[model samples]
Target: MVKVTYEIVPHDGGWAYKLGDVYSETFASHDEALEAVRIVVQEQQVGDEPVEISYQDESGKWREEYSDGGDRPEVEIIDRFRPGEASV
Candidate 1:
């Protein structure tokens, strides 16, 4: 399984969570951002029905495949403002 981490940090004069190079929308406060992360994590845990998925490959060719609902990456949230930690 793939491991995904949501890192909470200050961004755009507010707070937001980042996954790899992507950042979520900014929240007014750290607590608000943390709450948003909690909601996202909870939603991610809910499995969906398997269905045919389509995507474009690097060569610009369209590909379609059946996806398994049970297949999902493990995820966690990391708070950057915790005590004894200077950064995430």
Candidate 2:
């Protein structure tokens, strides 16, 4: 199983959560960002029909692959900042 993590971080003068290079929209506050994470994780748990996916590699080659809808990565959250320190 693939393990995924959402790390809370300061971004663009606001708070956000990021999974690898992907980031959620900036929220006005840390609590708001956390709430967004909760929603996204919930959606991630829902299964869907398997589908073929395409993506570009680092070498700029396009690749197609099949993804199993039943397979969901285990999610983790990391929030290192204390309440008042979250502001960017």
Candidate 3:
């Protein structure tokens, strides 16, 4: 996991993140931040699954079934993953 710092800024009508990639979100408040992170992580995780599932067909042939319920996963609090670093 790559560590990154996100900047939260006041946008046109609300708070936004200057660096939200596939793993982070920006907010004006702690509550909003928490919610956004939760949602982003869940959504991403559901989007990262392999698209095709293969299995043996009737003729012993491999068949593929499309998987539609997976998503890419994201990480939060990069510092949490720092080596030899403890977060309190």
Model 3 spans with C-alpha error above 4 angstroms = 1-26, 48-74, 78-88
TM per model? Answer: 0.81, 0.71, 0.33
Model 3 worst lDDT run, 10 consecutive residues = 79-88
Error of 2 at 52 (Å): 5.1
- Top candidate on TM-score is 1
What's the true lDDT of residue 51 in model 3? 72
lDDT per residue for candidate 2 within 1-88, as digits (tens), equals: 9887888989899999998999889999988998888788889899989999999999999999998889987887788875543322
User: How many steric overlaps are in each model, in order?
Assistant: 0, 0, 9
Q: What lDDT is obtained when candidate 2 is compared to the true structure?
A: 0.85
Highest-lDDT candidate? 2
TM-score of candidate 3 versus the correct structure, residues matched by position: 0.33
lDDT of 1 by residue, 9-77 (tens): 999999999899899999999989888988887788788899999999999999999978877768888
Q: How does each model score on lDDT?
A: 0.85, 0.85, 0.48
